[model samples]
Target: MEQDTNQNKVSKADSIRVKLYWRMAVMLLVIIVGILAMLAVIVTQGWSVYKRQSAWALASQKQAVWGLVNDARFKLEEVSNMQTELQVNLDPVFGSYIGAGSDFDQLKDRFGKNKGQFNASLKEIETQIKALRGTNGDFAKLGAAVRRDFNQYDRDTNKLLNAGDSGEDAVPYEQIEQDMVRTKKSLSALKARLDQERKAMGEVKALTIEDMARTLSILVGVIVVVIAALILISMFMIQNFTANMIKPLHESVRHARALAAGDLTRKLNFQPNRIITENSEIGSLCLSLQSMSEHLNAMLRQVDGSTQRVNLTSKEIRTSSR
Candidate 1:
């Protein structure tokens, strides 16, 4: 019966622990989930910020390439106009000079200005191509083609300017015209290539950013699951400690109080499944209380029997004296 009572107390404590710990678990789970959620937000925001910064750098590089392409296109137009102007002046009707010296001098001045501008523009394009070397080899190839054609055009222009002193009619207009045509075609192709490359790069960057976000999302999801598992395990540990350790201590205190109130009929019931072992201090204390109760009850029974015998002896003395 005592063992059964102890088992019942332990069972009741476990039931209460289950109820109380559920409430505690809810509160703790909320706090843990909130913290994990905050961490996920911070990580996501930080990664997004980094992704934006990286994308911005790539965009700036593409913008630089765009600006260089525009500058090259403008320079190419200028060179084509200069070549046409030179061809018009080379005509015997338009360029009938006061002297051969003035004709050579004017041609030299015009060719020098055009050559300097074209060289500067070509150099800038080459530099941009070098910067985009590993990024896009096709761009560099297109840029090289443009440069080659422009160089050929420069040579033809210089030949015409040098040959001008011979006679206006002797200028190689046919060769200059062919070189101009080729240079213009190459420049147009280069512009088209630049536009296509910009669009492709934008698409690639967008896809890369999307992949990174997806990866981060997977990682955060795993972290959240692990954190939730840890929270549940911690809550179980707390419940176990409350049920096994605290409940046993409370039972010991209650038993001690009952003994103090002179309830010797009741025993300090110890169940086999209890956390407090018979070798423990609480176990010894319970043993002492049980021993004290038994000793007090035995002494009370002896005192009552002695009082009954004394009353019987007094009754006999009273009858003899009467």
Candidate 2:
């Protein structure tokens, strides 16, 4: 019986330990899950920020390219206007060079200098357009077309300048105008494509940032729920452990105190058979107290019997002496 009681006690202790271990494991799992969720959220948010920054940078590049395109377009328009002015005045200048013969060389030199500057400007514009071409395939194609048109325009401008330098009457006004129109349209197309890309990039950035915020919010909510659950479960376990272990030990202490005061009449009433047989040290202690009380009761009964016999014997002797 004692061995069985010991085993039962061991079992109850093991049961409590198991409960504690399981609860601790559950809390650990919750903590780990919360940490992993937070890490995932951080990584996701970081990636979103990176993507947004990249998109913004690309949009800025596109805007800059658009400005360069406009600049090129204006340069082309200026070249076209200069060609028209030259065409209108070149014939009269050539006639005056032949008739007046004075200051003719100076006039030719000034016109040559102006033509050189215009050609240099056209070359610079071409270089900038080529630089923008590799940024987008469609832009490249449009830029190539623009380059072809501008090349033709440059050729016409050269032809007009050459005719004036040689005192010739022929000019390419019609061809120059056609080339200018095509160049303008191509520049417009390039700008339109850049604008479209920039707008799309902006939209993508907005959507990515919004999604990151939403996901972070949800993770935060999950963390809050996990923390709350951990707190609640901890409180419940504490209450249960205190009630089952501490309360029983306290009850055993009270019973032992009663036995210590020589109150053998007072029962060690650990109600509910399960509480007494719970394989706990407190239960065993309560049982020992009960056994002690039973032994004390038997001893008291024997002492009372002895006292009664002594009193009856003394009464008989007194009567016999009388």
Candidate 3:
């Protein structure tokens, strides 16, 4: 019976040890999961912030580029409008010079007075044209060629007007027409080119916005997924740990109650499935409990033996007295 009691106590100690290891394992798992979750949250937050900053930077760059393109377009439009006004004024001037007859000198004088204004307008146009040319490579070469032709036409017209005897007949109208046509064609080409550039700038801005948005969205998704996964893992670990700890405690409570009820025949049955690598307070407690149980059982046996001897003595005393 004593051997069985000792075996039961050993079994109970082993069981407590196994439960202790399981509880510790669960706790460690929870801690690891918690750490991983925290790391995921930090990483995801950092990544999201980075993506947003990058997107803002890209947007700023695109805005700057578009601003330049808009400025170029505005300059080109100003030049085109000036050229149209000049063409309108030149038509009547040309007709008057051709039909002036004997009053040609009077007309020529009038033309001379207006010439200053014309020259000023032409200079302004040329300046703006140069600005347009410098803005882009395609516009530069075309604008230079057009300006050269316009200059030649101006020279020819001035020379004809200055000659007193030669009259307006000396003016090469055909050449003027050809130069004007070329100028119009060049202006149209420049306008078209500017429009194309503006369009391209807009498209680039759109693409940049789209790419930035995509990056931000992807980063957000990653962050969410990581956080969710970490949460679930943590919950699972916590639940597992709770079960391990609670089951062992409940069993220990039951065993303790049974022992308290004076059931000396009843003993705790436990199994240790884990090894102890170091001395622990819990290990010492278990060892102490085992020792206490052994001592209690020994004391109980001595009491039983004493009671039997006292009964035997009492019966002998009674027979001698009779």
Candidate 4:
């Protein structure tokens, strides 16, 4: 009755083999999700970096400022050429010798031509000035200053031309020279600003590329760390699963070998083992080994009892014969 009660106390385990398969499936799912997540980040971040590098964003910056820099440069060149031609035409008209002589028609012709060309050049310069004033803040202010100085010089030049070849009331060329000096300084400031802005744009583009590289490097590092962690976890789980499944079978085998050698000792028959209450296939195997040991021990005990009785009866019969 005690043995039967003890047998009833042991609960059977469901198959652990199936649990092992499930664990493998879960690991595979984790790997797949990790891959997909990494791919998603790569695609999204790479596209964002590509756009930032110089696509639509840089194009808009060029349209707003960089293109104007080139335009201003070309216009400045045209202004220089026109100013040189104007100076060349007007230089002789202001000569004292020409005023004292009768080359008056030649002087008039040169003045008229210079005046007409200056008007055309002034129109183009005004357009350029408007663009300069509307763009960069410092650049605009410097351009305005340069324009004012050039205007002073132009006003004096026009006065000298209108009073052509007159020995009397002409502003000294030195006064006009001072205005051009100031104009040169202001134009230098404007050019310096353009150069600075272009340099800044180059630095910004380089920094943007560095930032993109840093962001991608960090992403790659994180992915590698996570994958390495998963691999360690998988190895640990595989080790644990293998131990749990294999150890019990080995213990059961040892018990069976002992029973086969006919060693029906208390250790094999009554000792507790993993087979007693396991919940998996190994548990069933342990239970079978325990049952076989139990039945054999019972049969061996009965045979010993009958053999003792027979020996006692034979001694009694020999005494009766005596």
Candidate number of the best lDDT: 1
For model 4, how many clashes? 2
> How many residue pairs clash (N, CA or C atoms closer than 3 angstroms) in each of the candidate models, in the order given?
0, 1, 6, 2
Model 4 per-residue lDDT tens digits across residues 1-322: 4664465443434456567667889898878887888888778877777766754344345345444444545554554455454455444453521233355456546645554454454445445545545444565576567668767866775565555545546666567567656766766666666666666666667767786988789688869977997898799878877776667667777787876786775343233333223445556557666676677778888989999999999999999999
Candidate 1 — which residues are off by over 4 angstroms? 1-60, 91-111, 164-171, 201-232, 272-322
Per-residue accuracy of model 1 over 1-322 as CA lDDT, tens digit each = 3652343343333344454566578767867776787678667766775776566566557667777778867776776776666655554444432224346467657667866776787788778678767767887888788888878877766656655455544335677788778877877787787777677667657766776677678668766876787678668766764566565566668877886787755655554234444444444455555665566678778888999999999999999999
Off by over 4 Å in 4: 1-13, 36-68, 83-199, 266-277
For candidate 2, write residues 1-322 as lDDT tens digits: 4654454343454355665677678778877876787678678776767777666666666666676666666665655565555555444443321313455445545545654564565455456555555655676677667667666766765565566457565445676678778877876777787778777876876776787677678777866876787788778766766676666567668877887887766656554243224444555565566566666778788888998999999999999999
Tell me the alpha-carbon RMSD of every candidate. 8.0, 6.4, 9.5, 8.5
TM-score of model 3 relative to the true fold? Answer: 0.47
For 1-322, candidate 3 gives per-residue lDDT tens digits of 5654443343343344665667668667765765676677557655765665555554444344344434444443443344344334343454333333565556555544454444454455445445444445565665465456556655665655543345444554566556556655654555565556655655555666676677667666755776676677667766765554455445446666777897664444432223321123233333344456666778888989999999999999999999
Alpha-carbon lDDT, every model:
0.66, 0.63, 0.53, 0.61
lDDT of 2 at 311: 94
Model 1 C-alpha RMSD vs. true structure (Å) is 8.0
Question: Ranking by lDDT, best first?
Answer: 1, 2, 4, 3
TM-score per model over all chains:
0.62, 0.63, 0.47, 0.56
True-vs-predicted CA distance for residue 262, candidate 1, Å: 2.2
Global fold similarity of model 1 (TM-score):
0.62
